[model samples]
Target: MIKPTERRVGYGVAMGYGVTDLFGGGAFAIIGTWLLFFYTTYCGLTVLEASSIFAIARVIDAILSPIMGYITDNFGNTWLGRKFGRRRFFLLLSSPLMFLYALLWLTDMNYWYYLGTYLSIELLSAMVLVPWETLAAEMTNRYEERSRLAGVRMIFSQLGGFLAVSVPGLIMQFTGKDNPFTYTLTGLIFSCVFCLAVFTTWRCTWEAKDVQPEHKFKAEVQRSSGLFNHLKYLILDLISSFRIRAFRLHIIIYIASFTAMDVFGAVFTYYVIYCLGKDAAAVSAWSSVGAFAAIPGTYAFMMLLNKLNLTPSSALRLAYSSIFFVLAFLFIVYYTKTPVPDMVFFGLFILNGVARAGLIYIPWNIYSFIPDIDEMVTQQRREGIFAGVMVLTRKSTVAIAILIIGMVLEEAGFVKGNGIQPESALYAIVTLMTLGTAVLLAISFYVTYPFKLTRETHKVLLKEIARRKLGGKAEDCDAPTRLVIKQLTGYEYDEVWGGEATRRVVGQVNCSRVE
Candidate 1:
């Protein structure tokens, strides 16, 4: 029987764990919403030139995220991690690094300097975020609880987006357009907020007990080593991670799905300003409603996943299908010049909002579960590796996507600081917004459809992971069978408690579901 204390997490801990999303969402939104425009208009670079600079930084991510994940996962297995907290140790340092945001919005920096600044922020964020994201897997092994954690994080992520879109727009309204100081000031303010949330979370929670490897492996890892050795391990860790079948498929499909988002988010304000021929107020109204709509949409997705009892791949396909249908219809209406009433326009934003919820939370919630699969293979908890790849891939795609969007704008003859764009540019904007979005979403669906990992398979995987963690040998079950077929290998003793066998047989174990 599960003890009461074992089953429930404190509200403070849960909320604190979640509040970091406010920082992540807000910071990313600020960059996503306006950084490109800032480059084009304020920094005096052409769209193509600015995009080139953004693309350069993506090269850095090829090394950055995986390294951090390797460090964090190993660190959690080390003495320092055991004493001071694995994930929490890094988080403590991450908050103060928020001050670095100031440099990003600084003026008089040349393109090279700007590239360095952009990369610096990316480095700092990875230091904190790779570990932070891994916490979802560590914090709980329960499915619905993981969903709740993802929900809380996404709701705040939307709030962060809300602030990034609305507040900055409101401030810039008074300060006038492309006022450089406006960005500097916004950076400092949100930087403070990000730091505070991170520190507050650190104060409220402790790291969950991550499973450690046997002594020989642990000792070799803990020996302070040179950079070359570290790089070797990172490469090995990555190789180990890619061995998981579902992860490879998931990453490819996720990239395709997220490209649509990167393009749409990069284009939203531009579309409103140019295609819709509207102002900041209109953009704010649309963004605010959309962000607010995501909160309800998150729970709505949770309910759908629960009630339909769909497999992850199936649920993902359905979600992407909804997005495709909406964007496709919106394109047809706009392209053909159907007289869209104000209500219809707002309703489309509402639908977009709901889709955004799935896009943000569903894939991420799935990330926590994937570590279980990796753990089954390596016999070590490696949430950081999987989480790192997810972030790394997502970040890489955003870089390519933003550059692509910028190039598209330049090709269409977009001009900066001019309220009006040419008819071709305007046409390009609407077409990209509608049909471009539809095609990408459809691609995501097709990418996801062939995968396995059904819902029933996932439950059995969780049970098998629990069995192993409890010191019961699993006989290295077949990956495709998902632990339903068990060969007797050997026995495992409870490492922490130093007790008798938690189990010798794989026959039914009584594990209760905790909320």
Candidate 2:
């Protein structure tokens, strides 16, 4: 096992760590953009049936994320955890399993077969993602280094997204666009890509030696031994993450922001094909060009957060505002039925790409620092639990939203693979693409008002945590630092850092007594 170092993270480490998002970003981009379309057109499924497959698989995967997180959190006590690594072990395990992704594109399968394949891939995704997401925190504590890692990761994510859209478009050009085999070939190619990316991440990343203390692990291992007790602790640990004020707010922001995008992605194809009267190839071409716009958008936001030190909330608000404009513009074009030129549509894709980049980038960048906030209240580095909770909320909510979108389209008399949709169906698609996204963005934008996290405040919070760790008296905390601590944790100074107030929280759980 390679020992983690305290040295600064360089470009090599950053690229290695970031590469796995090819799976993270690319796989999902393909699904969100085209999976339902493929299912309806090629697999002979209704809108409701297609969406049910996504919702069911994601809901199950969402439930499992935390369990996987807890296992990795304590896996260090096991031989595999000690030899391979708590987090990277799963990365190594999931690399080859990525081949299962190709099965999803197979045609003429029964509904159960489709459901089973989708569920398997979603579970595999949780296994790979739950642990991998924690590596950014486990790898480095520096805000700058963490930001660098996230920037590179999102860039690769965008690149994966780029390939996800572009490759399909190119493939379909050679092999007829309407052919089901086009999607099958796309899936097979990306499955190989997913396999390689996960393996690369396993090689490139290292977990911090001091992340989990010996005393804490011994206690945790003992507590989680029995089946019933493990279940109890898992539930408590997963729920405990929300107790941190920052984490709760972070989750609200994550769900509201991404769910908006999910709705847009789910409906955008139908809107393009039906509302705009364009072909599938046009959807792919415009989206692929937008993917190009995201690369620079990601880099610009990286500089905003790391160099200019923009507050995350401020950056998010800016991004959401841009997104809202794009949505409104699309609505107008559809509503007015103005015969817009190609350049105008292309311009909208460019703007959407830029806004979506910040939407994707800032929440995750903010997430890397969340455990630091959690550590203050719990005195434990429960990054896995935090990561688990984040994934759980994200997957569950996105699934539900997809389900609702599916239901709405079905209820509106949407027919599978129809070149022409009912007036009702077109109305539903346009409303979902515009009004649905606007509502989510509005909620997310409202939530960002009270969020006060920034680089300077985070630095202060970390310093106080260090002071508490060194056995400094809580009373010694200066006014400004104390306020920063209180604000971030949503607890008064005495109530945190092993204070009696936290005795009921997951951090202070006494597993021996629970039995």
Quick one: best lDDT, which candidate? 2
Query: What tens-digit string does per-residue lDDT give for candidate 2 at 1-515?
Result: 34464667988999999999999999999999999999999899999999999999999999999899999898888899989999999999999999999999999999999999999999999999899999999898788898889989999999999898889999988998788899999999999999999999999889984443422211222254688988899998887787888888888989999999889999999999999999889999999988989999999999888888788889999999898888888899888999989888889888888889999988898899998887777767888888888889999999999999999999999999888999999999999999999999998899898777789988998787767655567788888987887778888888776664455455544322112
CA RMSD, predictions in order: 6.9, 2.8
RMSD of 1: 6.9
TM-score of 1: 0.84
lDDT of each: 0.70, 0.87
- Candidate 1 segments exceeding 4 Å error: 1-7, 77-80, 106-109, 176-182, 209-226, 307-310, 466-515
lDDT of 1 by residue, 1-515 (tens): 54322455545567888888887788888887778777776787777877777777865865688888877777856887887677778888888998888778877668888888888888888887888888877877777677677777887787888788778767778886557788888888898899998897777665456333422221112333789977866666676565556677677777777778777777777877887666766776777677777778877777777677766667676667677766676567656766777677678777777878887777777777777665444445677787778777888877877777778888999997678999888888877777777777777677566565545666776665566555553345446443231211112212111111111111112332222
lDDT (Cα) of model 1: 0.70
Q: Give the TM-score of candidate 2.
A: 0.96
